[model samples]
Target chain A: MRQFTATYKLFLQHQITKGRLTLISVMAAIAVLLGFIIGSSGGDTREGAVVLIMGYGINFGVPIIALVLASSSFGQLKEDETLVYLWLKPSSRIATVVAAWFAALSAVIPAVAIPLTITSLVASSFDFSLAGPTFLAISLAVVAYSAVFSFVGLVLKKALIWGFVYIFIWELLIGNLAPGTSKLAIKTYPTSILINMTDEDINGDLTGFFVSTPAAIITLVAITCASIALTAWRLQETEVA
Target chain B: MTQQPPPPSSSQQAEAWPPKDSTIVARSLSKSFRGGLVALSELSVAIGPGVTALLGPNGAGKSTFMRLLCGLTKATTGDIWVAGGNPRKDAAVRGRIGLVPQQDGIFERQQVYDFVYLAAVLHNVDDPQSATLRALELVELNPQELTRPLGSFSKGMRQRAKIAQAIVHDPDVIVLDEPLNGLDPKQRRHMIALFHSLGEQGKTILVSSHILEEVERFGSHIVVLSKGRLAAEGDFRSIRSLMDHQPRKVKIACDKPKNVAARLIESSSIASCTLHDEETFEITTADAGAFRKEIAIACQKSDSLLSEVTPLDEDLESVFRYLVGER
Candidate 1:
């Protein structure tokens, strides 16, 4: 526990700068503003917000926020050779990986959840059906994306560049090209959670991406656990400078 | 033609390579990088407790050897045992080893207390706060400096901070690579004293340095490396005696260069002499030890005010080359 606190505090200190906070805040404002515009139009406001979230939130916002913060957690540590300081210790490597994962989650959760909450409120005008499912989808997406990106941060140099490529090529492009391939995309699970939980008739565009709730939840858990375990393995196997 | 001796077998290496109450041992250790640059090759050594200096030129694999021992890098081929356990395989064994790495990659934004405290926690120190304070105090860093960010401190202060963190956990083995690189004279003395003290307390402290004179203060036990291979290892005077047989280039600046040169060659020490100026001359000697002793007496006899006697190839790097060539 002491090991986790020390690693967690130090890793968190490197992130959470004024600039990142401002950027995340700006992204949230954009999500809320567009959701409000859809709300004022007065036609299927809940369904409209879900569509906006599915397009803007699931496809872009959640992944981007996760990418920036989670990847930098370990990526910057490697870039600067500070990883050696952390790597030399007697503490379990899993604790360090999980601490970094949690440190990233500490910021990612608020960064992701607050904006999504506001946008859902602005779009649905205080309805649980819209806000609740929207929150669930993003919350699940945050867990999966943070774990995967944290692993990416540990394994690759210029992690953000690779992260952006994966976002574009795998999640956005390849994800939509085939229904079968969508099962592999990280964003697809949240897309499923959002579509299957909400009014299916209203989300005609996203209705095709829906998988069963059990499958989506199971996949997200599998991805998060696998990412954490793989990260620990990498920390053990690779040589530190 | 003279026959070159065969390479020592692994068993022979265990007995011969400074096996003074041996604790850290590397057998048949070799490491090659991606681009075919071999960092360490067929290196074998046994370093026991005390202040043993690792001498080599830059790119001579001193840092690489240290990294492999600390389990920071994987050896291409070899087995290393630290404190009766291979640090690479035994994560618990790493708790007993500390490293002051060559690269200065510490978290510079954190205050000194935070930095050392993190190391203590990672090492599972019983009371991290007291341990951190004791470490900082040992390195002579004042209480007031604890709150300052590491980047804000001077080079000497930063070096002490690095040392403090390495020693914070009080491990059995401490590996320091060029540990005194940035310290001032006083700080270097303090650090050297601290290392000697640690060594006295039964801690194995392996220090690395390229400067011959700087390392001379680190006691007599030494290990010399050339191009990733063990050139020589033993008492300092023993290695010096081996090197004494090599021809040395010596330069003298004095009042009577000709007279000094004339008296210096009387004992067959000088192979040849060349006078560069009225006050300066150079000589190549078959026996450096003989010439070193003869030069001062020769200068005094000639009634010359001895200004300087400099050995052109006396640097540790040059010494390694000379030793490697002779072997």
Candidate 2:
């Protein structure tokens, strides 16, 4: 547990640099601004608000921020060879991966959540109901995305490039329209949870493309667990110093 | 030091090689990378608790062997026991091994204290802060330098900081790979003293270098590696004597190179002489000490001033070549 705490502290110290904090603030502000514009332009109309939040905020902004944070969890350290400190420890690989995953998740949550909550309130005509559910959905999304991306970061060489492909190609393009392929995309689960929980009157509805609420929750948990497990296994088998 | 007798009818006795008191034992170790490049091939040796210098050229698999011992990587085919535990199978055993890698992997944005402190905590030390500070002091890094970001540090300070991190946990075995590469003469002397102190404390110190003199300062115990194999392992004197028949070159810069070279060649100790220039010449000598005395007398008789005399082929690579060729 001390090892975990130390690793967590080290990861956070590396994460909360001035430049990254500023980037997070700017990204959140921009997402909120986009939400405000969409809400005011179509005043009290839930369809325009839903379209903007789903299309721009959830689909694009949240994933990008999550990807950056998660991919950098072990990627940057491995690239710089500073991962040796953690790798040569008496602690289990499971602890190391868990620490990195939690660090990335914690860092990504606030960065993506502030904008998401603002978008939710503005889109819901100042109604405070959707904020809680939206934040919950986004939090789950960040957790799953962070773990999977962290795993991808460890396993792949050019993880950032491949993360971009996974987001833009698999989730953005195929998951929306393609029939069989959409099931393979991770965003489908969290998006389903969001669609089911958010105000239902919005006309730009993406509810049909999602799985059931229980299934979404199960899949999200499964994805997080599987990714963390794979990361630990990969760390044990592979050599990096 | 007297060797401890092997435990009779024990499982460890079956695999023990190069002796019973050895802290690290590698038997028939080999490592090959993805492209079928064999970094280490059928290597076998045992290392005891002392300052044992691992001498090798650039591609002689020194780093590969060190990494294997550190358990940073596994051997493709052989077994290694470090501190009575297999590092590959036991993660906790890593706490007993400290490695100063050859690569420059400084956390540039972090302060020196934080960097070393992190290593201490990861190693599960009882009190990381105090251990970190003690390690820093051992390496002779001042308090002011500890607070500064590592990127702002000079090469020597960075190297010292690295040493601090490696020793912070007070491991049983410390493996330093080419640690003296960038240190100045004073820092090198200090580091030699530090290594000797650590050895006095009964820590197994395996320091790798390609320079013979650097290893000579630490102690006589030497391990020569060449082309992914153990060429020889023993005291430096014994290893040097193994290649005693080879002609050793000594270059001399004198006032009258021609006359001094002619007089030096007259002695039986001098095998051959090559005049490099008007004031400089090189001589192949079977006996370096005798040749040195002979050269001084010859220069005095020739009325020539000998400015400098340097042993030209006393490096680790040359010795490795001789040993490998003999094998």
Quick one: best TM-score, which candidate? 1
CAPRI verdict (incorrect, acceptable, medium, high) for model 2 = medium
Over 4 Å off, model 2? A17-19, A199-208, B1-16, B244-321, B324-327
- In the predicted model 2, the residue pairs found to clash are none
Task: State the TM-score for model 2.
Answer: 0.86
Q: Write the per-residue lDDT of candidate 1 for residues B2-67, one digit (tens) a residue.
A: 112233478677655535467788878999999999989999888889989998777888999988
Instruction: Identify the candidate with maximal DockQ.
Output: 1
| Backbone clashes, candidate 2 | 0
> For candidate 2, lDDT tens digit of each residue in B1-327?
112323433655675445867898887899999999999999878899989999777788999999898888989998777887877567777888888888887788889999899889889899999999999999989998778999899888888998899999999999998888789999999999999999989999999987677788888888878889888898866677557688898889999999999998999999999999988899999987798789889999999998999877766556667776765
Per residue, candidate 1 scores C-alpha lDDT tens digits across A54-131 of 889989998998899998888888888888888889889889989988888889878877688678778877677776
The fraction of correct interface contacts reproduced by each prediction comes to 0.82, 0.76
